[model samples]
Target: MFMRKNQIKCVSKAVLVIIILLFSNELLAQNQRVNSKSNNYFWDNVQFGGGIGLGFGSGYTDISLTPSAIYNFNEYVSLGLGAQYSYVSQKNYYNSHLYGGSLIALFNPIREIQLSAELEELRVNINPNDPSLTSEQFWNTGLFLGAGYRTANVTIGVRYNILQDDNKNVYSDAFMPFVRVYF
Candidate 1:
């Protein structure tokens, strides 16, 4: 039996969604380790941070906002969740919007080195200005592995998306540089 491209895309998306659901369930179970007696302990171990982006040019505009929170299980390990929203437009071309959520894990082997893994799922909508061109909508998933140099509450690093597909993924490339801060 042979599958068409669209069929394959649909199957792959379904598989990705299933995997994310299963993994998130495991991550949620970690909350059970928290002590119910002291709410302060939970609050004390939490950190909040994320990113904001803006760009504009002669005929283009882009904007993004991401906010996240993490719970430190210990000095060395942390787990978190994040939300994403992005809008992009090119005059006389197309406009796009993306909304997503992510699960992230951070590991610090020493005080200055941080390693991370992040899984993200986004819904993308693209609308073309020309009536002849059809609109498009799809789901995109990315798994990024990264390492960074950390100082105080900031980290600078690069990450590679292992699951990026040039045609279907939102990112223009598999490798992305990042600056992260937490407080």
Candidate 2:
């Protein structure tokens, strides 16, 4: 069944997260010894931040929440994970829920320039009020490549989803602009 598939995916993702955390714990132990002058160097290089949004218009509404964290491997590279959840509704149309997780990698070629690649997978559920339309549920995937301008803890840029196609996706368009910040 479709629900069974989604459950499997969720379990797989959770296992991956646990494995990554264990590996990171080992790295953290090693990094602390590498920099004696800065006792909290490893923790200092970790940043936490996320995004929240709400949109409402005539007969329509949307809400989203995403929480994420990243660890700077060095000045030039960082890797992170993010979780997303959203709800959308359009009166007389449909109501939908989407939840997902992502892995992101970022590179800084210069102090002001950043490039990134992100892989995301989401489960979408839709319910229609109209009896004629059937409810639907499925999984969607997106791979985005982007570039941006950075200042301090913020980055503003545009990203293109390489996996976007005719199939239903989280993004309606292949290109989207974004703003990211961490502290």
Candidate 3:
């Protein structure tokens, strides 16, 4: 009788351990399945959009138009390209027609917001007879860093020019505001 009682107690303990292990495994599997489903939904619905804006600064003012498109490769990474045109005027010295293409890489630290960096090569044509010098075609390169916020289909942000160069060193230290539309 004593041996039988000991045997039954041992069997009950073993059964309880097996039941807990099975329950935990099922919970873990369900959690993984839910995460996978969310990932799939996000990736299937990537987006693309662009915008145009006007800005003014201390010695310069510009009217600019930009068109851009983006491909969201994943939740954290996106690739973009844009075309921009601007008419820029600077304090009776130079008036320029600027056009450029930009390549951008974006990292999203959170949903609906992104940190972006871009490289652009712009072709600038100085107006002739502006009392500065002869008209010339020049190339300018710009590096920009900025943060952006998006709500629905509209995006708004400001970017600081980290570096700027012209064929002639006439202008530097520019900042601009940009707006984007995603369709």
Top candidate on TM-score is 1
The clash tally of candidate 1 reads 0
lDDT for each residue of candidate 1 in 7-52, tens digit (9 for 90 to 100): 9999999999999999998777756555453687888999999999
What is the lDDT ranking, best to worst? 1, 2, 3
lDDT of 2 by residue, 78-174 (tens): 9999999999999999999999999999999999999999999999999998989999999999999999999999999999999997677768899
Top of the candidates by lDDT: 1
Looking at model 1, the pairs that clash are: none
TM-scores, all models, native as reference? 0.79, 0.78, 0.59
Q: Model 2 — TM-score against the truth?
A: 0.78
Candidate 2's error at 86, in angstroms? 0.4
Per-candidate clashes come to 0, 0, 1
Candidate 1 off by > 4 Å: 1-37
Overall lDDT per candidate, in order of appearance: 0.95, 0.93, 0.77
> Could you tell me which residue pairs clash in candidate 3?
50-181
lDDT for position 97 in model 1: 98
